[model samples]
Target chain A: MIKARVTVTLKNGVLDPQGKAIENSLGSLGFKGVGSVRQGKVFDVSLDVKDEATAKHDIESMCEKLLANTVIEDYQVEIV
Target chain B: MIKARVTVTLKNGVLDPQGKAIENSLGSLGFKGVGSVRQGKVFDVSLDVKDEATAKHDIESMCEKLLANTVIEDYQVEIV
Candidate 1:
C-alpha cells in the first residue's frame, strides 16, 4: 500500500477569513505576539495500490479534481 | 520573527465523517484503490517575537488552549 499526503492552502491573493478569525481569537486569548495566521487543510490518504508512482500521479489528479480548488487554492501531494 | 506551524488531527478511534466522505468521493470519481482518508487542519502561525524558546512555549500553550481541542484531537507544534 502507498500512503499519500495532501496539503491544500489558499492562494497568495486570496483573503482567508478563517485565518483572520484565528488571529483575532489568539489575540483575545492573550496571545498578542501572534501575528497573521493562514490556516489550511491536510489529508492523510491510504491507497491500496503498491506502486508509488501510480499513487503519486493519481493523488495529484485527485488534488486537482476535488481535493483543492485550483483557481483559489494550491495543493501538494506526497506519496510515501 | 518565529514561524510556528501547527497540525491538528483527530485522535485514534475517533469517527471522521469528512474522511469517510472523501474516501467515498474518490471511489465515486473512479479511484477505486483509495482505501481510507483522514483529514486534518493546518495552521501557519507567524509570531512577532524573535526568541525561539519563548515562541515555542507560547505556541504550545496556545495550541492547548485554543489552536486544538486536546480532548479529541492531537496537535503538533513546530517553531521555525
Candidate 2:
C-alpha cells in the first residue's frame, strides 16, 4: 500500500478570510510580528496500488480533476 | 523572514466525515482502489521574526494554542 499526502493551497493574491480571522485572533492572543496567514487543505489517502510512479500520477490527476480548483488553488502530492 | 507551514491532522481512529465524503465522491468519479481518505488543515504563516529558534518555539506554541486541538489532532510544523 502506498500513502499519498496532498496539500492544496490557495494561490497568491487570493482573499482568505479564514486566514485573516486567524491572524486577527493571533494578534488578540498576543502573537505579534505575524505577517500573512493562508489556510489550506490536506488530504491523506491510502491506495491499494503498489507502484510509486502510478500512485504519484493518479494522485496528481485526482488533485487536478477533483481535489483542487486549479484556477484558484495549487496542489502538491508527496508519496510516503 | 521565515515561513512556517503547519499541517494539522486528526489522530488515528477519529471519524472524519469530510474525508469520507471526498472518498465517496472519488468513487463516484470512477477512481477505484482508494482505501482511506483523511482530511486535515494546512496553515501557511509568514513571520517577521529572524531567529530560527524563536520562530520554531513561537510557531509550535501557536499551533498548540490555536491551530490544532491536541486532544484529537496532531500538527507538524515545517520551516521553509
Candidate 3:
C-alpha cells in the first residue's frame, strides 16, 4: 500500500472568514505576536497501489476531481 | 518572523463521517485501489516572533487552546 497526504488550501486571493475568526480569537486569548492565520484541510489516504509514482498521480487526480475546488482552492499531494 | 504549519488529525477509534463520504465518492469516481481515508485540519500561521523555539511554544499553546480538541484529536507542529 502507498500512503499519501493531500493538503487543500484556499487560493491567495480568496477570502477566508474562518481564518479571520481564528486570528481574532487568538488575539482575545492573549497569545501575542500572531498574524495571518490561514486554515486548510488535510487528508491522509491509504491506497492499495504499491508504487510511489502511480500513487502520486492518482492522488493528484483525486484532488482535481473531488478533493479540492479548483476555482477557489489549491491542493498539494505528497507520498509518504 | 517565524512561519509554522500545524496539522490536527482525529485520533484512532474516532469516527469520521466526512472522510467516509470522501472515500465513497472516490470509489464512485472510478479511482480504484483506494483504502481508508482520514481527514484532518491544517493551519499555516505566521508569527511576528523571530526565534523558532518561542514560536513553537506559542503555537503549541494555540493548538491546545483553540486549534484542536485535545480529547478527540492529535496535533503536530512544524516550524518552516
Candidate 4:
C-alpha cells in the first residue's frame, strides 16, 4: 500500500473569502505578525497501488475529475 | 529568505465535518475509488531568517500563537 497526499488551492486570480476570514480571526486573536492567509485543502489517501507512475495517473485523474474544481483551483499530489 | 511550510490537521479525536462534505461531493462527481477525505491546512511562509533553529522557533510560535487551534489541531513544519 502507498500513501498519497493531495493538496488543492485556489487559483491565483481567484478570491478566497475563507482565507480572508481566517486572517481576520487571527488578527483579532493577537497574532499581529500575520499578513494574510490563503486557505487550501490537504488529503491523505491510502491506495493499494503498485508503482509511482500508475498511482500518479490515478491520482491526477482523481484530482481533475472530482477532487478539485479546475476552473478556480489547482492541485498537486505526492506519493510515499 | 527561507521558506517554511506549516501543515495543520484535526486531532485524531475530533470529527471532521468538512472532510465528510468533500467526500460526499467527490462521490457525487463519480469518483468511485475515493474512500474517505480528511481535510487539513497548509501554510507556505517566506521568512528572512538565517538558520534553521531560529526559524523553527519562530514558526512554532506562529503555529501555536495563530496558525493552528491547539485544542482541535496538530501541526508540523518544514523549512526550505
Provide a comma-separated list of chain B TM-scores, one per candidate. Answer: 0.93, 0.96, 0.97, 0.93
Query: Of the candidates numbered 3 and 4, which has the greater DockQ value?
Result: 3
Q: Against the true structure, what is each candidate's TM-score?
A: 0.95, 0.97, 0.98, 0.76
Q: What is the C-alpha lDDT profile of model 4 across B1-80, one tens digit per residue?
A: 66677889899878988878877876676655555667898876655566778777877987898888999999998975
Candidate 1 lDDT by residue in tens digits, A24-75: 9999988877888999999999998868888888999899888999999998
lDDT of 2 by residue, B1-80 (tens): 78999999999999999999999998888887889999999999999897878888999999999999999999999999
Best of the candidates, DockQ: 3
Model 4: CAPRI class: acceptable
Docking class of 3: high
The lDDT for every candidate, in the order shown, is: 0.89, 0.93, 0.95, 0.77
Q: How many angstroms is residue A20 displaced in model 1 relative to the true structure, after the best TM-score fit?
A: 0.5
Interface RMSD of candidate 1, in Å, is: 0.8
Model 1, stretches more than 4 Å misplaced? Answer: none
Local accuracy of candidate 4 as per-residue lDDT tens digits, A18-44? 868766776676544555567787887
The 10 consecutive residues of candidate 1 chain B with the worst lDDT sum are B48-57
Query: Could you give the CAPRI-style class of model 2?
Result: high
RMSD of each: 1.2, 0.8, 0.8, 3.0
Interface RMSD of each: 0.8, 0.7, 0.6, 3.0
Instruction: Assess each model's interface with DockQ, reporting 2 decimals per model.
Output: 0.88, 0.91, 0.92, 0.40
State which candidate, 1 or 2, has the greater lDDT. 2
lDDT of 3 by residue, B2-79 (tens): 899999999999999999999999999999999989999999999998799999999999999999999999999999
Output the lDDT of residue B33, model 2: 83
